[model samples]
Target: MWDTVLIVDWSGGNDRGASPKKDAIWTGVARAGQAEDPVYHRNRQLAEAWIIQFLTDEHAAGRRVLAGFDFAFGYPAGFGRVLTGSDDPFAIWDWFAAHVQDSPKANNRFDLAGQINARFPGIGPFWGNGLARDIPDLPRKGLARHGHGIAEKRAAEQQAKGAFAVWQLSGAGAVGSQVIMGLPVLARLRQRFGADLAVWPFEPLTPPIALVEVWPSLIAKTIAATCPPGAIKDAHQVRVLAQAISALAPEDLARMLDAPGGTAEGAILGLGHVALLEQAARAPVLRNDCFALPQGVHWTPVDQALAHLRQHLPPVAGVQPQPLAAAAGQYLAQDVTALRAHPPSPNAAVDGYGFAGPAGTGAQRLTLVQGRSAAGQPYDGTIRAGQAIRILTGADLPDGVDTVVMQEDVQATDTAITFQGPLKRGANARAAGEDMAAGQIIARQGRRLTPADLGMCAAAGIGQLLVYRPLRVGILSTGDELRDPGSTIAQGQIFDANRPMLAALVHQWGHQAVDLGRAPDNRSILRGMLDQAAATCDVILTSGGASAGDEDHMSALLAGTGSLALWRVAMKPGRPLAMGLWGGRPVLGLPGNPVAAMVCALVFAHPALALMAGGDWPEPQGFTLPAAFAKTKKAGRREYLRARIRDGKAEVFASEGSGRVSGLAWAEGLVMLPDAAMTITPGDPVTYLPFGSFR
Candidate 1:
């Protein structure tokens, strides 16, 4: 799908009649339409003209033209080699060199191989025998010294507008060249252009007359001989090769196409087509389907389950605890009625207070008479002329007393207090209904009891609270081989860990866990226990007896009861889990394995209990983590893996097996590998459902 090409000279020109001669001219070309086919020519002038015309025409058409030529854009010494046979082959090289070097009008130029090697004297061809030999680094160098002559030429042609894609083939001539040269170019291109670019390469070689008939055979043989054994046979080898070629400049393509030994442009095009096909194959596909319920089964989603339980569960009817205590500071309220502030009348807060005065005379002083009120009790008598009441904080003022003078501002004599400061009528007094009026609703139903609520109710004179009863959950383990802890463990018997685990889990949800004890493997015994549990408990939870074995009586009993909602879910480990109602009570039957039982209980039991308690279900939350190792799983089954986060990434604890308790023990949380994921690799992001996400 890419529209540009840059061809460079690495094996030299094909003008010397397919001889062993190394004479080659690195040419740059950009074309929108096909050019005239090449004819046998001794002079390299035609080849040069074809390149210049292709580039000029493509540029004129407003298409992005990528020109690939031979030369290390950085160090000249690392440029690709040009084959030559003459005594002074440098002359032909100098002539071709003059074209690119002297053409100042050329724009957006890029050199592919050894064309720029003159700038770095010590560097050599990367793929030749001595590719690894190091060279001295250049200093204070600009574009000319960097050997980006072709790129400079192309830029001049572009008039300095858009960016250029330059491919620097690092490894090409010798052993290990495929990877060494390909990886660097691919990595840089991906970094610059993202992963969407298409790369194609052509290998060209002019064959000698003696080898012309066997040239095709020789090309394959030489490739096989030069590549390591088994390299060509590797499944990923082609992919790697394509990725490498994708990084080369177009000039490299032209130079290789002009090689003396072989040329197959069609094979290069095919490789490119295959690469595109592979990318398409990697795209994801989706399918749409609804969750199915088993025949005659009445399963409901969690939200519906909650609503059903709430509607069917019987409400508790009983006397509730009184809101307040009786002793001093112990009981703030004594009855069901709201609280009332003291002083059925008006009151004063200061001392040396209160007497009634005429309506017009403002300055008034009254005699200190009776000490009347406190916070809880009100003053009863009235105040006469020139008489005032001595009041304390929150004390009620007597009738006919409208004002009071501060004790500090009154001069006290034997039987009377004289006022030094003038007093205004009704000063320093408290009025009725100032703090609270009666009959306001201070507390409501279904509200969590907080200290503020309690205080507000107390202030409003509420003495008792009407709170709902806590849900009671029954926990039963249904395995015959199970035994409670603190008892002697006989051979072939395991401790009843599930019972305590389930009980503690229920308690954690703010519900009472009614231990129904472990039931034997007999159907009648299990039925009787479940019946009794359903009679009193809001929900009944049992572990084991839900699998396909003959001893798995839970599913059978549930089916017989005609109230079983769902027998099996489309999930792993917990697939045998059964959700149903027994004797009008909700029942959750979990798998026998400890981990499976625990996980299912967290996922389903917690929500069911919260529903029974008249609460809403919460959604599960998880984080993203990179998979620690590659994994392959069944295509249509969602698998939950108990894993731990390591180095800020997810790592499965161990291979998941329903019977493996050690795996659960080592896990920090669960990793939800979806059903659609067929395989996972390191660094692949996966949903890390932490243990906290469950409960």
Candidate 2:
């Protein structure tokens, strides 16, 4: 059962700025048992960050989170394969995450729509570009284009009249931009939370976090009639919808997540049908205050921000019985105890003669038994007092042999052996189970099996083990200005560096690296690949399209689609990271810059991936070192500088600029500066993280 319910009314337009306004991003969050007023934000950035923090807090409090975003999670079915080269519905989210660039003052949604239209022979499906910008292929009116390639509305919308088509990007009740822009956020959230986050319809439901598409218009009349005249209508609608859903039993939400025979595009989760809204319209909207945070709070502490991830993000992988031969790097699902003693019976620790009891002071001579004992072969008869049997290292001690004397310390003759006096009992003789006892646990659950662990397991007579499945991480990238590495590059395009680096990073982390493929700046193609990616991987790591730039599609697409949680992480090289769920998988949307992407992946994603992979959250262990150079920065944020150890001190890279990819090669590790404003001079101690430590 969901312990927390959140309703979000998303807007695709630019930031509303410090003032309260209608048609902005508004959200209503209510615990399953509580009623609350919806919260409001001026822009997607703040709203997303707040939502993420809220979700994190709820998870920390052991609450199951269900968030409903007001947008289509997908476009029509044929539209997907036509636009993205895939039939999976969530491919659109991937498409949007790759191609849509957005900022408060501007966005390329209309341009993206125009680009999508150009992919078809003619524009007939999408319509209405009300923006002042003259997009090439997109038309100003629905009638301007013809030869419809796909249906204008989804099956869910067809059952509910007065619902606007997903193609309507402008004019009254258009939700096109809001939709594609909202998906990347979900894709990111899926990446960030890993197995802990899930989506509706496309994937099975899971606890802690889940996302569902919503439409406030399903119950707009019910909310409008009951709201006070002065209140913002967007805020009022979300509050009412949240109330209706929260009032429902747990099974009702489950049914919505698994809508039967869902449409090719998406289904609005508000009422499941127009009739349900009609049935609930008579109930008045309530005014209640729910979860609220202090206004204007920004720049979360870096440690506090990323530290909470492991505490709540549970492992999404399942257990499998794997032979020790193939279980390296996989986490254990159960303990592996010893099946037999390491040395099953007492044996000679050294090549020596064995006899019963201790020897008296002074050199002593004893007669040796006729037969000798070697590894895997033991003397058949028991040794009597004053007699010794020849033994080899690792040979089982014969009966009555309590001690052994090394051959190096004895003079041997044909029938007798002489050794030093005052030999202690059991000296140089291995007792049974000395190295390991039977029934002793050799390795515990959730331990990442290493070469040593496998060796120990083998010695313990364990041939197979139950291990958690390795996390499958999909790596994706997007940008028109980007071209594949080693490909012929155009004048303006740079080779794609992020995807390859991230894929390598994923591989280095011991998780399965899935190349989700790359797409040009077009949205439809990206969507097809994204849907394929979501279907293929458990978590995704996307570099580029993660920032507020007009070309940043990853974060924008997620805002209104799945659950987008923006983190205003206070750190240099990387500050903002987009996290969300797309089609029930986790996604971590990283900065476009290569340096920032690598740093963020190390600082945040590594431990997160480990925890998601059924292993303990591991923090990089760094050592303090003296600084060979001096530097200073503002105190509010922590900073990481690429540096190398020179003459026993840390020497920073020539420049602090992130674009200097050469710096990454030049430095051996990173020197971290604390949050306080302080200058580092030569001889000052600072924390240094070597590249090896992260892995």
Candidate 3:
């Protein structure tokens, strides 16, 4: 993934004479998750120098840079071989570097085209010049232009609509001059970067500086919608494109930079013929790994599996603004900075008498003022040296007030109050901005806001918050021997317990659960159910039929159609875990047994759902307590024992089998054991995870 993105609109014309007009040289720079306005340059030389410096600084800071230039990087097939005797595109770049005579505002691009045409027979391919005088062998129009033993359009240009051929030099949408001038800049950048630069569609993208060709016309609608009125289109194109690409999720950006389309003729970064680039910039949840474990891996550790999920999973929720009252329990889409400070001024911390006192004075009796200072009312005049005013709690401390004595400590008479000794200076006095400050980020992006967080936001003068919509998780139960809770169970069938429990869990986690009811073990029924779930839900949760067996139709159908990954975790009571994508929606398959299903949901699915719901990855907090009973255990994997706190010590259930559905109801928490063989004695420390923490 790139840490910085630089998009440039190259110009072939001479200096536009300062004052920042359109169609000169515009470069947009996006870094650190923010994009700035495009910088304008009057000439190509100044733009080239500025870009080189920007790239150099970014590389020096150890940031990967992706540079996109809006021009054709290469000619059609066989053109490079005809010009440089090789099919490699770099060979043509070398030729252009050696022959092109470029200055600050003038270049020999037209003369070079005429000279190149002299080598061919009849009228040459490069045509349509704006020269004041006619040049030999170069035609003024394309009617006499020859094919020159090569195709007229590159493969990428053929796919892109309104893409003018590189041969046209003096017409609307002409790119021939731009290609001539831009390639030399690329050549110099490569020379300067040496081993650190990579030109895409020509080589692999393992270097720090990735140079790719871009056509902004592919997303013309997006640019038109985002660009401001009366602004230059060239500058807006580069600026908006940089911001949109920079906002893409990391995995999608890498896919867009897939290289080596062809060495002779380059391809645009995105296909340019399809809406894939537009969708990628607007919505980026399409680049998940289906939670598939790495190749050659099986029975992954729980911690490692969690880490993989955190790395690959993306936020799939849409964003919007809501009032703070309705925004509770939603994930914040942006940072909320304080507009004004809470406790806006200095005030009294408690009810007391206020009067200015001398630095080293002993006890003194003062006259009580006529009026009292309440919460919203203040005394008009400052307290004199011999007079004190009664100040209530939360009342603003008036001017010339240094210290306040508690009313309980002062001996009050009908007209005067007496204090024993000089109190500490500024005692019981609150300073300005004691609670909050302006410009302070009270809440960060991707944070799950609580009731207290809403209160803090309200105190800081924030009325509305931009938040992500709640994730819709579908609860699907698929099993042959499953029945509804109220239905009579047959000899081989049992009532379904996991569906209601999981739906409740989803509700507790601040997500909506779309109950998909139940599907039989038949593949056709399960496939139809999954398809429907994918259409309406952000994530799907399957109860049973997840194993690699004939009756496990969920796994069978997923493997056949979309993608399947059976993640057998190295933990007890919860191992039969499956994750996949059906119709582009994430699906998590849990074990059939009630105990194991609940455990897996808490230990694995909880955090994953939080991430997909656009909140930060939640790591459940656990505390340690002494074990109430002693036991010997050997382990190659971690284990969670259903336990509860008894007599201030952790106690495990009598049975450790997953078939004991009552154990899930009886226990209040789970005790986590590490993957190491050890004997537990009485009073040994054990880690306990509460059920409430999972929420």
**1-695, model 2: which lDDT tens digit per residue?**
67677998898888998877898998887642235777879887788788888888888897787899988887766888887788877676777888888777888888788888988876757777878868888998988888757877777678666777788788778787688678877877777777888877677776579888887777767777788979888887877777666544343345556676545566678444443333333322211210111246577777776555754566655455689899999987667899988878888889888898699899899988899888987778888888989899989888889898888899999899997789889899888888889999878877899999988888888898877667889988888888888899889888888888888888898999988777666666766777667656667888887766666677676665546667777899998788876644567888878888888898988988887777877879899999899887888899999988988888999888867777887888899888999987889999999988988
Model 3 lDDT at residue 598: 91
Better of 1 and 2 by TM-score: 2
Model 2: residues >4 Å from true position, as ranges?
Answer: 1-297, 520-525
- Candidate with the larger TM-score of 1 and 3: 3
Tens digits of per-residue lDDT for model 3 on 188-219?
Answer: 99999999999887788889999999888888
The C-alpha stretches of model 1 lying farther than 4 A from their native spots are: 1-466, 693-695
Over the stretch 346-393, how does candidate 1's per-residue lDDT look in tens digits? 667676556674323334445567455666676778778777666666
lDDT of 1: 0.49
Query: What TM-score, computed on C-alpha atoms, does each candidate reach?
Result: 0.38, 0.58, 0.61
How many clashes (backbone atoms < 3 Å, residues ≥3 apart in a chain or on different chains) does model 3 have? Answer: 0
**Better by lDDT, candidate 3 or 2:** 3
| Backbone clashes counted, model 2 | 41
Give the Å error, residue 240, model 3: 9.8
